[model samples]
Target: EVVRQYKLGLARHVNEHTGRPLSRATQTYFLVALRSLLRYWAMQGLDVLAPDRVELGKAPSRSLKFLDGDQLRRLLDAPDINDLRGLRDRALMETFFSTGLRLSELARLDRDHINLRTREFGVIGKGRKPRIVFLSDAATNWLGRYLQARQDRWKPLFVRMKGKPDLAPGGPGMRMSTRSIERLVGKYVRLAGLGVKATPHTLRHSFATDLLSNGADLRAVQEMLGHANLNTTQIYTHVTNPQLRAAHRKFHSGNRE
Candidate 1:
């Protein structure tokens, strides 16, 4: 029912008239959920069942979007660290910049996940693949300050209040949800006056961009980013072109001629 209403709302929002999440993907999710509910009821012989008329919706692969360095810097510098929220926001932003973590991986980070001495942190990402990320002194020191201001024994490193991590949607003790972390990123984006569409993932793109611009190998960046495919890292390669163009313009004989 919720999915049905959501589809209707989405259609109405996208068009002048109301529509349903009549997409095959939407149907699959709704039908699968209904089947689960029906099975639970049938185990007790309640005879409940989902109607069989439902079908799946179609979906296709999509490209990702990311932010550039100047815009990124403005965004990072946007957070107000004098207050609690600002401190927390800066810490999260720093973590994203330094680690290139998926929002889920970052949200799941606990006290045990961070190690200041090694300048590293551990993240269990997609497929539960564990990867180690080295944090810069800038990131580590900022994190330390954020943790110091934080007043919680909760497992997640970033929390909302006394007992809850802002991204931890499950509750006080559980790590925050990926959705919650995304929302937090959105709020800070506006505050930073970036004037560009961005989210937490933009930090990941910036991480790769900065690395490529610094002359790090593309393969090395792929490993750091935990991408299964080399093509994913190729997008950041474009960022390096602007720098190359600048260098050529200033030093090349072609410009002199």
Candidate 2:
């Protein structure tokens, strides 16, 4: 009866800031946490409810958000290349689109990690799994230009250009934080007038969607995106399904009649 009441309360919960009902995912997360706590208590011989009694409600499928080609072009051109900071921003955006790297993985990059000649590098993604990420020619050229303009020999591939470097032992030394990269991407998203909220992860989605839309094999994209399971990569298929339908209608022999 207590668990039933708790479930009802969660279902009726509202978001304080948004003034909307709590999302299904959020509700499920709360239930999962509670279940874990109950499990621990039960293991300690406490008279708590059984963990298996806390059933999680199914959450709706997540909507994948990505920039279209025109939006991507506008964002890529948003930064003024003449300025050093602008150059860095352009390179950073290009790399995001080129490599589909998670924000933290990109933030941890060092100057020596990339090979401009090869246009490829390896990154440790979620689960501490390593995968190879490739760069586009455009990304490579922009990165080369950005590196050439920098005077300091900072070890980090991307750095906070606005601040002075800390040369102290174990200091970050102008290394760009993940938060800074998030803000940087947000700034360009506004400048480009995308009229949609986008983050660094949005570019990663764009990268995956763009490839799938262009007829790249799904399994290959799964590898590039470093997804632990192919099911995670399958989410982008819905976004490309319309294009596939259109192509079938146009080219399929059955449509000739």
Candidate 3:
């Protein structure tokens, strides 16, 4: 009875306090926190509930959010190229889509981390595991143009312009934060009129889905994504309903001549 009450209370807390409708992801996080707390108490020899015995809420499988080819084109073209900020924005968004990097990973990159000649770079992903990510030709080109336009010798690959164009390169004010990258993504998403919620992570999702949809091997994508588990990468395998219908119509026995 106590365990059941605890579960209900947690669910209520999520719905009533967290937000309306309670996101499945947030519910899972709440459950995880509860389990961790239980484990800690159990270790201290408390007569509390067993952590492993607690049931986790099942999250309904939802379609992954990603920009289709047209949307991607529109977003990539949304940034203006006529000015310094525009050039940097173009390169930043291009690099994001090309590399599938998490926002923190992308924002923390230093100029030295990139090898412009090879157009490939290494990033330390989750768990401090290092992996190589390659840039598309378009991404490379924009990055080159952005770098050429920059007069600052800033070591950071991307920097924030603090109101003054004359700020010295490599100064403390030049670094871009993760929040800034999120806002930038939001800005372009609105500008492109995509009518979908696209954070910087959406570009990452698009990158993975694009690879998977084009017949890239699952395991190979797992490696490229730096996922610790193949199951985590499997989520990208879900295709749009239209693609499912097309496949069914093309290959089903009933459709055969």
Best candidate, lDDT? 2
User: Rank order by lDDT, top first?
Assistant: 2, 3, 1
**Which pairs of residues clash in candidate 2, taking residues 3 or more apart in a chain or in different chains?**
none
How does residue 152 of candidate 1 score in lDDT?
A: 60
The lDDT per prediction is 0.59, 0.73, 0.69
Tens digits of lDDT, candidate 2, 1-257: 88889889988987665578865644554565577667667778999888778787653435326777888889999999998999999999999988789999899998888888866677778766666676776788899999999887778889897767688753456789999999999999889998778899888877765655443444555567776643443323113234333432332221232
True lDDT of residue 126, candidate 3: 79
lDDT of 1 by residue, 47-125 (tens): 6544342232333434224555666667777888898777877888888887678787788778767877666655556
Which residue segments of model 3 deviate by more than 4 Å? 1-64, 163-169, 230-257
Runs in model 1 lying further than 4 Å from the true structure: 1-64, 162-174, 230-257
Better of 1 and 3 by lDDT: 3
lDDT: which is higher, 1 or 2? 2
- Candidate 2's TM-score reads 0.65
In model 1, how many backbone clashes occur? 15
Better of 2 and 3 by lDDT: 2
**Best to worst by TM-score, what's the order?**
2, 3, 1
